[model samples]
Target: MLKVAIVGYGGIAKGPHTSAWKKIENAKVVAACDIRPERLDLAKSAFSSNIGLYEDYKEMIDKEKPDIVDICTPNYLHSPIAVYALEKGAHVICEKPDAISVEDALKMQAAKEASGKVLMTIRNNRYSAGSQYLKHLVTSGQAGEIYSGRCGWIRKRGIPGKGGWFTTKAQSGGGPLIDLGVHMIDLAIYLMGNPKAVSVTGNTYSKFADNTEKADSSHATFGQAKEDGIYDVEDLAMGFVKFDNGSCLQIEFSWASNIKRETRFVQLRGTKKGLEFRDGIIDVFDGGRNTKRARIKHNVDARKLDTGIAKVLNGHEANIRHFVDVITKGVEPVFTIEQGVDMIKILSGIYESAQTGKEVLL
Candidate 1:
């Protein structure tokens, strides 16, 4: 049994990770730490086995010496905490966005290399049956050569206003681009075989965030709202990425928008087959003498697979299992730090493109 220590006992810790850990046969949550005492208390109440709790995560690490450190912190703190965990001889599983900047992502990669420890970011979208099927189609030469793709996440006025950290540039990084778009980006890259992003052109907007009068009407949490403080982050962002393989991707993300539909979708076009998913249904259109449509069905618990926390924890478990198997049985992880670094670099390029009003060449 691998002893696990969870850092940051927030909504995610309570919701998904805690529940998922219960499902794992040989894994246990040995320790949990959070900056807030009440959060730590909540965790102890939930898993009352004399599970160690501490306000300082470092203290928990030093005392428990867990085999795995699961980081569910904000985007900006991912690097520091993950690096610290790896250095302390614990394999690390970090919640996505990995870090706020490319430089920090590289630093985390360096730490992982130096420690010779497993570091996996939670992008659970890749573990979904739909994603797995799609990957199989692409890799088995069924989808043929993928040319161009469009991937986006659209939400109608879904800004998490209650968390000031999310709106603050220093804490959560950019809004939906980093928070939600990262998942789509990861999926796109995974499907495209981690192609090098050659250039990016993007744009960001925060017009809706400037108006606070509609805060409650928008269903956003207001607990962390400051009456007159800065809310400097993008409410919507869009980007175009050109890959080294000559294929391109158009990406879109929005936290608050007036759009009619709130959905996450990816459309991929290839020489032999085309795939599109909308409203949880996967459709494949084949390019052959007799064109046909194939409807794909996935086996998944709808109740346990919807939320980001659930998806992330599910992916985390898969990653942890792979890491353990690789370490003990001499196998290899499906994904690597190099692929993660490339994703971050692409994200950074998109942000730079939006900032400079010009295409950022990789």
Candidate 2:
């Protein structure tokens, strides 16, 4: 059995990790760590009756000596905690936005190389039935030669609670761009066969954050809004990316917007065929007057497919199971550290472009 340690006892830890871990065989949560004592105690009380708990994750890593370390911490701590875990001879599964900066991401990559341990980022979108089928079509030339694509997560009003690490750039890196846009960007690039990014042009806005009344409306789950705390992150971000192969991508993300629908959509246009996944439906359009809609059935329970939270946990379990299978069978995991680093590089370029108001040549 592969022993595991879960670091971070937040909503994700309780909702996704705990739920998904129960489904995996030969894997057990031996310990859990969090900075918050109450959160740690809560995790211990709810998830595992006999699991060890600690305020310092490093302590947990040293004592548990787990085969895998699942990091569900805030964005900024991803690299440090992951590197530390890897250095201590544990495979690492870090939640997405792998690191805040490209340098940190590279450092994590280096650590993985040196440690020779599996390092996987939790990008659950890649595991969706819709995504998997779309990727197969794209790779099989059903999408033909792609020229352009657009992907976005548009929220009418969905800011997370204020005053948390999420709102602080020092803690969460950036705002909606790093938080939500990263997923679509990763999915888009992956479906595009990990294209070489050549340049990026982008913009950011925080107009909605200034209005306190709009904060509650923007947040989908509002635990508590600290009216006195600082909100310095972007509420919205948009970027245009050009690849070395002449393909282009237009991306947008928002915590608050005036859009009519709350859409999480990706549209890909190819020379011979076009594809779109909008509002959970996947459609294919061919140039020869052919159109087909791909029906997606939830292999798992409907309750298991709600938020990214559920998806991430389920995805993490699958990812870790695959990692273990690869390790035991002498193969490589589907998602590698190099791919994770590439994602970080692309996101960093987008943020740089938005800041400079110029096309960042990568």
The model with the greatest lDDT is 2
Candidate 1 versus truth, CA RMSD in Å, comes to: 4.2
lDDT of each: 0.78, 0.79
Error of 2 at 354 (Å): 2.0
TM-score for predicted model 2 compared with the true structure: 0.91
Cα misplacement distance, residue 163 of candidate 1 (Å):
5.3
Span of 10 residues, lowest total lDDT, candidate 1: 304-313
Q: What tens digits encode model 1's per-residue C-alpha lDDT throughout 150-200?
A: 999887767775347778889887788988888988888788777888888
Model 2 ranges off by over 4 Å:
214-219, 222-224, 288-290, 298-316
- TM-score of each model, paired residue for residue: 0.89, 0.91
Candidate 1 — which residues are off by over 4 angstroms? 213-229, 287-320, 327-330
Top-TM-score candidate index: 2
lDDT of 2: 0.79
Query: Per-residue lDDT of 76-129 in model 2, one digit per residue for the tens?
Result: 989999999999999888888899988889999999999988888887777666
Error of 1 at 130 (Å): 0.9
